[model samples]
Target: MRDFIGRAMMTLYFTVCATLKSGAMIVALRDPTWSWARGISVAADVAALGFLVLIVATTVARLPPVKTAQGIEPRLSALIGCFATVTLIAVPGVQTLPQLELVADLITIVGFTLCIWCLWWLGRSFSITAQARRLVTAGPYQLVRHPLYACEAVVLFGIVLRNPTWAVVAIGAIVICFQCRRIINEEKVLRSAFPEYDAYARATPILIPSISTLRELVFPGAR
Candidate 1:
């Protein structure tokens, strides 16, 4: 019952966010002066929508039943709310001049790449909610405990960069705060569920890359 509610809430939240993003893209397209810019924005928005759909499908198919916690984390809820609000505001009001648009495009490319890598890693260890799944400690997981969230942050940052509105920047900040809280909760859950998680956490960096660890993972022959 708890999992059901959580899933429903999450779906509703995403739906709202998607609608806002689509609306924003439409507004951007309607601007006659920025034809090329509008086109690029539309393309990026479409790509983001596609990626979001894939994420929802994959998460639904792969994740285990979400245990009903005491309450929804306030920070997480704030993040979603702020993101939706910003998307709606940004769509109609934010001006994406050519120069800013180009930067956003590059960031989007990098963000997409990171997202894809994280998704691939997650796919390998993914399991259906109905089935029991074990902790994943390989691939991206070997580097950071919350690589997916980090990738998500990158994506959000790219969106903000593309838009660069005060509203969007604020939304991104809220998202970061929410992600931090979510990570803490996830770590707690992992520690409780997996005996070896503590050792893994000790060895792996949370978000940033550790040079020594990266060296070890990438070039085992080096040391």
Candidate 2:
């Protein structure tokens, strides 16, 4: 009974969030002032919204939570990181630095593109909070344990480059701290649910892709 209600509520949450954000993004994209480079931000938003909408699909797919770490810590950490990150990048501040817009835009595009790919790869395994919809060990998962969040970190780094401010620096720091913790909490659930997760974790890096992981692709015992 409680589980059913919880799933229903989550479905509603994702639907509403994805719809509202997508509508706003469409409007923003249609604005005359927005250049093609600015489309990267929209792409980032779409990637996030796409993931949220996919969360609803997980509910419909009836993928049960094999394990979930659902205390305040996991939830609060992710919320704080996301909130801080969004606010720092989205909001305009009083002081603006002389930014290399093209470089920043390119970085952001790569980051968000990777995010979208990973999110799509995850498919129904996607969830905002620390919960295991299912175990996915292919595609981007082969490179890193949490490729979505890893690429998001890259996105935030590019955002900081665009808006180089003390406030942004402080908030981005907080975002990184919380996001790293969110990874731990998420892994707790994945490790709990899938027995094969240990071997996967051993092979892949946590967030950063490394030469060793790449080398292992050929040698299979390079580590």
**Best model per lDDT:** 2
List the RMSD of every prediction in angstroms. Answer: 4.6, 4.1
| TM-score, cand. 2 | 0.73
**lDDT to native, each model:** 0.62, 0.73
Clash counts per candidate, in order, are 1, 0
TM-score of each: 0.73, 0.73
Per-residue alpha-carbon lDDT of candidate 2 for residues 59-101, written as tens digits (9 for 90 to 100): 5555556677877889889768766765544443233432465
Worst 10 residues of 2 by lDDT: 89-98
For residue 156, give model 2's deviation from the true position in Å: 0.3
Model 2 clash pairs? none
Clashing residue pairs in candidate 1 (N, C-alpha, C atoms within 3 angstroms): 24-91
Cα lDDT tens digits for candidate 1, 53-99: 55555545556533322345743453464445335323533556778
